[model samples]
Target: MSKRYTPREMLEKLISFNTVSDRSNLDLITFVETYLAEYGVTSIRVPDETGTKAALHAHIGPSEDGGVVLSAHTDVVPVKGQAWSQDPFASWVSNGKLYGRGSADMKGFAATVLAKVPDFIAADLQRPIHIALSYDEEVGCFGAPPLVRDMLAKGPRPSFAIVGEPTNMKVVTAHKGIAVYKTTITGHPAHSSQLHRGVSAISAAAKLISWLDAQTADNKAKADPDNAFEPPYTTLHSGVIKGGEAHNITAQHCEFITDFRLLPGDSKEAWLEAYRTFIDSQVLPDMQAISGDCGIEVEELAYVPGLSEEADGLAETEARGLTGDNARHVVVYATEGGIFQEHGVSTVVCGPGSIDQAHQADEFIELVELDRCAAFLDRLIGRLS
Candidate 1:
């Protein structure tokens, strides 16, 4: 962990950590802490309750308010089921792209920012430049809110934040929010032939999933035509389901996870209320009629707010000026940008690499993308100076 490493070298070292969402990111966090310390920058470590994962927040230049924060997530998605041409942890260059885990969906941006530390430290800055990196973002943005709170709570909070989720170095003004929920169904078990004596949990789960499908259709039909989003509406889906024991026995337990992405201004509370109402008034009564102990439990696991177009133009103007791109874009994916924005920091997402390459078997970032990000950071330093 040397300070002399270039952005590409930083990315290579970052990729070697194997910081999958489920694993600890302490090693990467420690490396970043050490790297920043070499330049006389002090970073605050925001540790999670488990004390195994942590987020790093650092500031360089004047310690006053109104600085800009460069944000990125250190954890990457798992490489479990994917087929790769080489060791996923060993980053390598081929053609003009850098290939490895976390190269695009987001360690590249982190590297680019870290690489610019020398320039930022050298500049005669009137305003500070903050670096904020979090863990477990791939797992529903689980690790950023606390980190944001910690930074803001320390006083003289940043004026704006740039969330470096891969966007091919384009300025993104809006993105969808996601709310993940887990539903569990309990019912009596009995022989299939004795259908009247038992309630099938799997049957109940199917009905709930079908209800979600109907909601998805309704959302598509009622989508806002003026919205630039691809689907132009909030979308819902049931992603994982598990239940049942034997073919001849009615299921005694079932569980499924459902999540929905919300367009800006869409309310997940109302959507969840509607689903809860349906279960309580329609599904639950039917289940209770079969068995008094039968029940359905639904709870929200995570909710990441959508980045709204209402953000102040500070970050947007800076990004557009740096990249010379005026075209505004909206994305279906969720990012930590929304969380930053929600906490009163005007935030935008502009980073290297296409998100299409993210979470794939052979994830990569174009070499030019890294170069573009480097140029952007240079301009950012100019702005702070």
Candidate 2:
């Protein structure tokens, strides 16, 4: 009899852990660590320098060069203000789908990976089967850097990474990287009649937004572009904006967030420079001129780099064969694969559910998909052998 945990059972267990992105994922990490220990596996916890969160790396097979890594994030986005038929922390399987907060954006993948440990341990493996469970991936991919740094500082890199981010098990090779930023526009509040006496933070916000408009309009000139992405290009957008208390007075402060998902080979500095130039050339001068203390500034809150789909060689061929797909794809969502690729590990994103159902109310994954993924893993094991 197989010791592997069933897909539904894995989904339930994963949902039971509230690994929200902002909160510590230590509970989830502890659960996985305990689970892995049961199989007699030793792992490393690469904690973020702040010591608040950590990512895990465990190898269950032979220690050798060019092995494979199955990776996923342990954190899920918050469930605040979302309506659900079932509890976000407790999973429900109904109408043939498992529903939970991380059910699709993918605790499902993590569960599957953990369940298959017995399979991996039982095999006569010649190479390592590494489990890379990361933290804080939803908050601009912050938790993955420490683990990536750990891999970098440690010798012996893996050959490929399978970022299990719910592509319905299709192979994805490229995606746009998203670097998020928050800008602060500080201005003096004065009587509405005295417009010139106090600079309008909203107006300053407009200046910054105009630059973003120009950047979006001018993204046509990137190094390489893939039409497969919805926009067929990198994109920059302002997410949140806040300023005045009432319409009567000049707004004292304004703040907003920006998201930049860059195309492959597109330099991050170049994208950021466009907005910096706008702030320097336009917004700051007027604000500073109004009052010596007035100013506008930007800071990166989070960054997740896009993965280019240029890797289509022997290793990719091996992944393709394992999953029984002769073709490859590009995922619109972001993952740690780009970071892994940056560190000399080839990566392909293939997993068990559709991203369409992820990160929303009543998030779910079809049980059939999980079963298919388990079969896919079995195929991978056979091919590796």
Local error of candidate 1 at residue 49 (angstroms): 1.0
RMSD of each: 1.3, 2.3
TM-score of each: 0.97, 0.93
Write one digit per residue (lDDT tens) for candidate 2, span 106-203: 88888888888888888987777778989888877777777877765663467788889999888887887888889998888989999889878888
Best by lDDT: 1
Clashing residue pairs for model 1: none
Give me the overall lDDT of model 2. 0.81
- Residue pairs clashing in model 2 are 176-306, 177-305, 177-306
Q: RMSD in Å for candidate 2, one decimal?
A: 2.3
Ten consecutive residues with minimal summed lDDT in candidate 2?
218-227
Question: Mind giving the per-residue lDDT tens digits that candidate 1 earns over 293-375?
Answer: 99999989999999998644788877788889899798999999999988988888999999999999999999999999999
lDDT of each: 0.92, 0.81
In model 1, the Cα lDDT at residue 37 comes to 86
